[model samples]
Target: MPRRARKYAVRTTYATNAALALVLAGALTACTGSSGSDGGEDGKAGDSSASPTAAEPGKYRTLPKPCDVVSVGTLREMLPGAAAEDDGTAAPSAGASPYEGEPTATYDTDRRVGCRWKNATSLSTRHLNIDFERVVSYDPAVSDDEQAERLYAKKARKAGIPLDPDDTSPDADSEPDPGSEPDSGSKSSGSPKTDSSKKDGEKGSGHKGGTSPDGHTSPSGAPDASSSPEDDVTDSPSATPGEDLAPRSLDDLGDAAYIDDELHTADSGLHRDITLVFRTANVIATVEYEQWVTDKHRIPDSQELQERARELAAQLAEQFED
Candidate 1:
C-alpha cells in the first residue's frame, strides 16, 4: 500500500514542476519581444522628430552711423558752397573738421540711417543726402540677401527705370539703339522735343547766353547776362540722340544699381536732382544730389550731377565691403 502511494505522489510533483517551467519561459519571451519593439521605435525617432530648417542670417549685423560715414572732403564736393577750413586745396584733418553732416532722424539705427547736407551762398544752393538700409528676413526659407533683392526690385519698379535697357515691351519707354529716331516734331535731328525739353533746351548753357529759366519765350530773345560760353553743355549725357534724360539701370555699380536724372522748376529757381541707388548683399545705398540755381537761365547739368552721385554710391558700397 505504501509503495503505490509513493509512486503517485512523485508523478504529481513532476507535473507541477513542468507547468511552472513552461510559465516562466513564456514570461521571458514576452519581455524580450517588448524590449526589441521599444528599441525599434526609438531608432526611428531621428527621422520623425527632427528639427526644421531655418533661414540664414544676414551678412551685415549692424549699420554704420550715417552722418559720420563720409569725409569732410567728400562733403565739400557733394555740397558745394559748404564752408571749408582752407581754399579746397587739401582735405581737413579728421576730428578737427568743422563739417559735421546733419543726421536724419530714424526710429531704428540698426535697420536704417541717413544723412543730409546743404550749402547756400550768393552763387547757388546745393544739397546732398545718403541713406543705407539693412534688410533682415524673418521667413525660414528666405535669406537676408534675398530680402534685399526683393526690396531693390520694388525700388527699381517705382524708379520707373527699365531694367532691361534694350527692352522693346510696349510698356517700356526706352527705345533701342538702331530703331531709335528723333521725333518728327523736334526742332532738329537732336533729342525729340517735349514741351519740357524744349523749354529746358532754351534755358540750357547751349546758347552763349542762356534763355530765361521761367519757361517763357524771352521778349527780347536776348542772351542771359549771367551765361558764359562754358555753360553751353549742361553736364547732360544723351540717353539717345533723340531722347530726353530718362532714369536708367546701371550694371557696373553693385549687385544691382540705377540712376535717375530729373530737372524741375521750384519756387526759388530751376532745380536739378540726381538719384543713384545700389544694392550689395543685405545692404542698399542711395545717393541724392540736388542743385538749385538762382540764375533762372542756368540749368544744372544732368550728367555732371549723375557722375557725382554715382561716385558717392561706390564709396558707400566699399564701406560695407570693408
Candidate 2:
C-alpha cells in the first residue's frame, strides 16, 4: 500500500461587526511526503528535541556607533512651498551643492522624497509642517508583517480580546455593546403637571414648561439625553489622546511595511520612497525617507529604518489631536 502523507492544518476566522457584521473563514494545510522504515511514513517522527533555532545573536549585526547623518534641512527648507510645485517634482534649489559641510549636516538637494505634503499649515504658518529626527545603526531586514502582527496581538490583549492559541475563533459573546442609549423617558408615560405663574406675593413661585422656582429649566428638559453633551464625548476610533499629548520618546513606535518596487530615484544612487501610512481622525500622513546605497549593496536590512519611520508617523499623528 502507498504510504499516506502527513498533513498539518490551520483554520482562521475574522469577524467584523459595525455597520455590518461579516465573518470570514479560511484554512491552511501543510503536507509532508511519506517516509520509509529508515524515517517513518513521513521523514521521521516529529523531533521534539530538534526544534528550529532562532537567528544567531547579532548574526546580521548593526553598527554599535552612529553612521553618517543625512541632513533633512533641505526638506525642512523646501517644506514651506512644497504644496505649490505643479510639476510633481522636487525641484532643486537654484544654488545648492550635493556635498557640503559634515555628514551630520543635511545635504539639501531641494527635492522631496517618497511622500508629498499638501495644504500643510502649522500654528507658525510655516509652509511644511512635518518634523523628523536622525537615527544611527539602522537595519531593514526585519519582516514588518511580523511586527504588525505582534502589535495587533498586544493591542488585542490590552483590549480584553480573547487570544487563545488553541482556539482560532474569537469569543463572539465577549464583544462589547455598541448600541445607542435607550430612550430616557421610556418608563414615564404621563407628563408631569405644569404649574402656572404664581402671584408676586407668593413665597413659592414657579412657571410653566417645568421652570424651577429660581427660573432655570432642568438640564434634562433643556438638553435631551440623545443630544446631551455626554453624547459628544464618545470614544473615537481614530484618536489617541495620551499619545498626542505625551512628550516624544525613543521607544519602539511599532512595525511598518513598504514595497521596494515603489521606490523612486532622482539621481543614480540617491533613492527615496514612502514606506508607511498613519491616520488620525480624518487626516492621513505618508512617511518617506531617502537612501544612498552603494553599487555593491542592492538591498540593506531595513528593520531599524522602519522602526524610525513608525516614530515619525506617531509624531505626525500627534499634530491632529485637539
Winning candidate number (TM-score): 1
Q: Residue 299 lDDT in model 2?
A: 28
lDDT of 1 by residue, 126-243 (tens): 5677777777766556677776776666566655566754532232123111212222210111111123342333222222222222243321122222322332224333222113
Output the worst ten-in-a-row residue range by lDDT, candidate 2: 182-191
Flag regions of model 2 displaced more than 4 Å.
1-274
Candidate 2 TM-score, true structure as reference: 0.22
Candidate 2, residues 1-322, lDDT tens digits: the string is 2233222111112222321331221111112222234466234446643554332221111111111122244433323232232223333453122212111122321211122222122111111122121111111332222222333333333323334456342322243212211111111111121222223211111111223211333212221111111111112222211322221222223232221111221122211222343322212223443222222123222333334445555554443342
Clashing pairs in 1: 191-242, 205-232, 235-301, 235-303
In model 1, where is the ten-residue run with the lowest total lDDT?
184-193
Q: Distance (Å) between predicted and true CA of 319, model 2?
A: 1.7
